[model samples]
Target: MKTPLLQFTDNGIYCKKANVYLDPWKPVDHAIISHGHADHSRYGHKKYITHHRNVPIIQHRLGEINVTGKEWGETFDVNNVKFSLHPAGHILGSSQIRVEYKGEGKTSILFGYSLGKAQRLLKYLNTDIGEIYTHGAIENMTEVLRPLVDFPKTTLITRETKKEQLLGNIVLAPPSAHGSTWIRKMVPYVTASASGWMTFRGARRRRAIDKGFVLSDHCDWGGLLESIEATGADKIICTHGYTDIFSKYLREQGYDARTEATQYGEEETEAALASKSTASV
Candidate 1:
């Protein structure tokens, strides 16, 4: 059998042709990261490549490091393989890394975290969509990112603000504020959550959300199937999240599908822990 262009390895998704890894957890010579999320983008690489907008974010998180920033859709070559970064729409600097070798292309989260998801919501949303209001936490985080991203105007919720002012506005807040007295001012509001989990049946109800938008940084099941079909890839590898079940279903559909173990899914936990630490401070 021919060696696949991309292979699952101890380090991460590796491309032997390019001698590089994608979002490797273990240290490697060169790593092409998809985003700045902790799980996807880690420290200890000799060289790093990611979307240009992400440079500040990773630099802030990882400290001084050798890194290169690439523009969306700008193709570069390493060895015989071609690579490019495409907007992932997950966060301000998030990207979907595309690797092409022998004319094949492959493509690969949540609003809960303030830094990434909150900014994404702010960027895409507009006054035409709805008046954007944000909790102080979200507002503060967004202000930090204002220099990096062009965000829509957002109003910070304040004690002086009247409930009537929020009547028809979209309020962006963390999950912790959902049932708190801080949210009482928005009592007449309809609760909505934007998350991949919203795709699950009854997820909205369980969260007491009056409306659920299947807006997520990650692909839903339907999106996964659509993306797979679009790729026309003979071999499919599932790295994380319902991997076994998803791979099995893919096999049942006659695709060469399999699962690979990876160190992912810890980003949310880390983000939650960080949030708690910040709250305590």
Candidate 2:
């Protein structure tokens, strides 16, 4: 058997050719992070690399770490392997890292968390989609990121703002606002949530959401399959999320699929904490 270009280790995803880790949980010499989320971009790494927009985010969280930022699609060499960051459309500075040694492989919107998800929606969404309105919380975070990101014009909701102004406009708010009195102001509005959990049947109904966008920072079932197929790799590794079942299905399909244990949170815990924080706001 050939040595795999990437290996799942106790820490995170390891690339033997580069002698570096991707989103390692434990301390390592060098780590190529995917995003600023605590689980993905942890502290204690000697050196860090991520999207340029994420430089300040991790810095703010980790406090004084040696890190380098890279632009999307800018390939850099590590040992003999090539690596690049591509927009994942997850959060403000979120990215998907692309790794290649020999040759290979290839690689949405509306009311979300103010910090990461809101910025993502703002960056990609446009007036062409709909007139954008934001709660004060979302607006405040967007203001801080204006220097690093290009966002569509978003009117901040205020007492003086007429309900008529919100008509035909998409409003972005924290999840806490979903069933709160604040949202009641938008009478006759349709409620929706963008979350990975939406993949489950009745997720929207459970949350009382009128519509579920099925948008997530993480990959969904279809996304995982599409991504795997695009990689042109016969080997499939599942680190989290129904790993056994997913890998089993992949094997049934004739791919070399397996799972690895990881310390990364599946986002349920993080989502709970975020919910609490936003609920207080």
- Top candidate when judged by lDDT against the true structure: 2
* Segments in model 2 whose C-alpha atoms lie over 4 Å from true places: 1-109, 219-281
Q: List the residue pairs that clash in candidate 2.
A: none
lDDT, candidate 2, 107-172, per-residue tens: 011457667777887787645424787777777778889989888888777767776666656887
lDDT of every model, 2 decimals:
0.77, 0.78
Instruction: Please give the TM-score that candidate 1 achieves against the real structure.
Output: 0.45
The candidate that achieves the highest TM-score relative to the unseen native structure: 1
Per residue, candidate 1 scores C-alpha lDDT tens digits across 142-244 of 8888998888888777767776666656777776667767676455666767777777899889988777777677778888999999999999999977789
lDDT of 2 at 255: 95
Model 2 accuracy (lDDT, Cα): 0.78
